[model samples]
Target chain A: MDFGDSPEESEFRLRLRGWLQGNNPGLPTSSTDDDYWKGAAAWHRSLFGAGFFGMSWPTAIGGQGLPSVYDVIVDEELAASGAPPRPSLGYLVQGILEHGNEDIQARFLPGIISGRERWCQGFSEPDAGSDLASLRTRADRQGDDYVITGHKVWTSYSDDAEWCLVLARTDQEVAKHRGISAFVVPMHQPGIEQRPLRMINGMTKEFGEVAFNEARVPAVNMIGGPGEGWRLAMTIVSHEREPGELGYVARYTKVVNELTRRVRVNPSGFREDQVRDLGWAIVEVEMLRLHVRRRLSDRLNGISHGPEGSVDKLLMTWTEQSLGHAALSIGGIAHGGGDDTALNTYLYSRAQSVMGGTSQIQRNLVAGRILGLPSS
Target chain B: MDVRLSTEQQALRESVARVVDQLAPHAVGEIGNAERTSKLDAAVASSGWRELRLGDDQGDPLATGVEAGIIAEEFGRGLADVSFLGPTMAAELRRLAGAAQSESAETVAFTSDLSSIAIAADGQLSSFVAIDASGCSRALLLAARSDGNFLAEVDVASDEVGLDLTRPSSTLGSPASLEPSGRSISDDDLMRWTALGLSLTCADLVGIMQGAVQLSTDYASQRRQYGAPIGSFQAMQHMLADAFVMMEGSRSVTLHAAWAVDALHPRDAVGAASVAKAYCARAARDVCETAIQVHGGIGNTWECLAHVYLRRALLSSDIFGGAGNSLDRVLQHYGIGA
Candidate 1:
């Protein structure tokens, strides 16, 4: 409803910003702006081990136990400085909590909090990507355990992930959307296979695909009930619009500022005509930032982010792509000659509209849920 | 940010949606009959559905985007023809230009067969072609000079003949010669209003193209060739995928433009809206064409519903400058002659 950071939030933001200002491992001379994650992959763990990462988590679980927005502010500033990712998986454990059993949390929560255990999502099967509910993976019940068998693609954090939270249809008799269960899967279990999905982006550090065959796990691994898998999945998906955590605006700020500076190039460099959109690209980026930030801030203040997230997700990708497009404009043909820069951005942006949920699906939700229209 | 509408706005979308539901004849099968085919007269006539006409007393702007988004969705699903562009957008224009303008323009119709009039060299009225100019209301004239300040409105009877029949049209007042109202709109206001128009149109485009995709996706899933679903074909899949991507881009740009209209400089907002409109128009065309193309030879038949989207797409492009025009405008805004 308002843009001002609250007294507590401002205090939190100031503290976080102050810490980031002094402690920031600014982009390395050799490391590009985006390489913060790829370059400082291990340093990221140490940084999170300090109080700067996962702010609101319980102190017993390696956090300061402040409000979740405390983390949001940290991210906002970190993103402003284009810092490498700190522990990005605080709430990701909630997926485990909802899907993982109590034993799983007791063992892993400490490490996750202390930035030791990194978990990746393994719901996407090679064949069952968007048709996630219809995943074909099989986990046959074995004595005192189950043997997992399946291929999972787009397992975004599998490369260095210590564990994975997986969604598999435990029962197939029920329809596609129902009759499934979730498990806190161990990544290093015998028969587990992981391979980096060579992305259009040249590097692959965290995001990769995972496959499993006869991977053994204990019976106590299940989080919620056996047949309520879709509900669990819904919880994860719905949280996308839950506000604050999605740090898109923070990321966008860096892009926008960089864009403004790079917008007009010198003939010695790049000129205004050299760029296709110029000021408009910056405007689009700001529009996307405000669009998401307004909703996220409102949600942080306790307003539920609703059909508006559709507005956010949609704009996020557009602005991301626009930023990428503007980057290409500034960089020109020579900057990212091959699959390096603009092309990578163009391809990644293509997935933004495709991934999470397709833009069409968002409209369907807006029409049916928000606008109260009948199903098409 | 905060895309949730106030409860009041929600109610307005509901009300307009209900009215559209009631007035719907062709899509609902009421006017689908031969006898009622031309009964658009009873449907859109000034007296028949004055609410839809959008007079000064019509209502608020809620129905334009959010509500109209719903209406356009269903209208696309039903593949109905409502001439929404002329009636709804024209109404918004009236609200924007104001009631005083419409009424004063009406008075000029009386006592003269004035096709159009002007403030002359000395700032006075001028003549026009005479017709059955007799038996008209009292005539009056006003100053309408200067650019972006005023528009001269000359009224015409419904019975008047015109080209292009989906909806009525009239030669607008002397856009160039009208006297100035001496009012200067903030550039932000100008941008905001134009954004409103473009955003609403983008919303409508989303609805229609969604219908087009639905038409194609559904048809492909059901219609069989070579004993398999056409939806399974890689070519169709690629087409649908691209359509999905372009449509997503359109949707994103629309929301972005809407936010800009709500909160940015009006002069600059045209760029954002231009992006949305240009993207939307192009998507509408691509989606509709592919929808029909995927439907194959059977789709070309009028018996099928695909052409409705095709026609609608054609109409949408022209509404706020075609794709090419908007693209030029967007590029020109950047000082890039492209």
Candidate 2:
């Protein structure tokens, strides 16, 4: 029941804190800007250069072979020091490490870990979002390459990524989930095109619509055997849902801390309900922090989780929305004051329930898988 | 950091769950069943859970707050018709004040608003309510002074079968005689004790949510509608899933609060407990209400166990103050608001 860090964890945290003191890349003005993401990539490279990035991955790759808690500490210190977020490549790394063959691993993981290559996931199409297994993407086998043709929406970082981990149908006669395969398709091929989408938060480069017109990938680039795409996709989504592994707790904490500072700087300006909202926001963020730590504790104790990742996703959604509302209310609802970060924060939070998996879908997974409820 | 329970703590939880299963009231009518109540009381007495916070040789508690919280949570889950929260809180105060432990059964008295512990003055206790007062002869209070607060005790005036039927509370009918325990309590001691109280209530709220969700989930699986179990409906499933998520979040936060009570500084422990209380207090009500909604018409009736959970949740929510008060505590700690 001890919640204090171990000697090793504490030491790592302290050292990371000291490192961040000098190496901090101050937070960008707007996440929607191209410069923000460009700075983000540079920050990722800097952290990697400092031996602070990817510490949880195996040493066989580019990581330091430390416990996952070190990643959490790096995230916590980065946020606490107002640094740009660590590059969210954990899910991509996990997908490749779990499903990629030794050849694929040896070729891609080092570049990904070292931030030499950027990657985006190509799973959700316009027609296959919640029902991702029904994706229309196709990869036809050729002599030495599989030419892919698909449309991927909400493909984050696609505009800048050099590689896209894509899911495409390899067989037409089998079940929807069984017909699919995963590939590490190069993003800059002649047949590939990326158009950045403007989010409600006015973020364009953050999410893009990528179109694959006979994009060629070598046969060796396939992540897993045919019909293994579903498993790989599931691994990626589940890993993505873990706030602890993804360092999302620190991200939310950063937002809540800013809101608290605003309210403290001018305490009487806010209404009671708005103040209450801020307090609730603080509570939700703390809940996420403790929840992630508890999940980490479970991992430390060798407890493997499956659909329970849905629980983490739902909690993260609630916390993000709560923090967003707190920001909006405290920042004032009326617009046009030369400051739209609060509105942007709220707008971005709306994606929490929509992206990764819709809240409804996540709930259905929790019910059917974790609670053993009957499917209708 | 590790939040997993130790082997002994796990064993303690299992034992408490067994006791609750064996003797806890299973229905509303069984709440006052003398046979079951007395047996439950006897089991609780022998279990020494209420004495968990009693001072050891060095005036530290016999068991940490996490152990006490585990017992509290299990009891809350089964709606065990006995006293644990009140007696344990009294023992905690005694330990903090370095006073000798009471021999007979005792409980703690809270203010009329149920926000803070009651303060006795001039050998008379004012408008106060003693919660978890079942089978208790006296309630403990504090005597305020310039130097520090001291421990005091008063007779339980009368029992009031309040909104929560499982556990009875007592209100002072007259000024109960206050007797000084002769040990002073420091501000740090009180803050730490408050942290423990907040944590136990949060743990109880977690248990109540768990019990409510389990009851609703079971019913949803069995109750048929439109030629299928109601649980098969997406609406009902989502409701139950949301409730389950809230319950797990509460459990995670509460575990940290319970651990922080003994591990951190007094003020920091209270801060952590306040965070847990705010989260658990808000989530418990929602989860309990969702449980009622899941059961449809039966949930509205008194016989259904869903309302019992809601009632218990209401009491635990208000014990250290509800969501609003907890938020204020947190805000105050941060010096963020007037």
Best by DockQ: 2
lDDT of 2 by residue, B227-269 (tens): 9999999999999999999999999989999999999999999
Locate the minimum summed-lDDT window of 10 residues in model 2 chain B: B172-181
Model 1 reaches what TM-score against the true structure?
0.64
Model 2: how far residue B227 lies from native, Å: 0.5
**Alpha-carbon local distance difference test for all models:** 0.55, 0.87
Residue range A37-82, candidate 1, lDDT tens digits: 4545565565665567666556665667665545556656766676
Q: lDDT tens string, model 1, B182-288?
A: 24333443455556656656766776677677667777777777888777565666566556545655655665565555345666667777776777787788888
Residue pairs in steric clash, candidate 2? none
Quote the TM-score that chain A achieves in each candidate: 0.84, 0.96
The lowest-lDDT stretch of 10 consecutive residues in candidate 1 chain B is B129-138
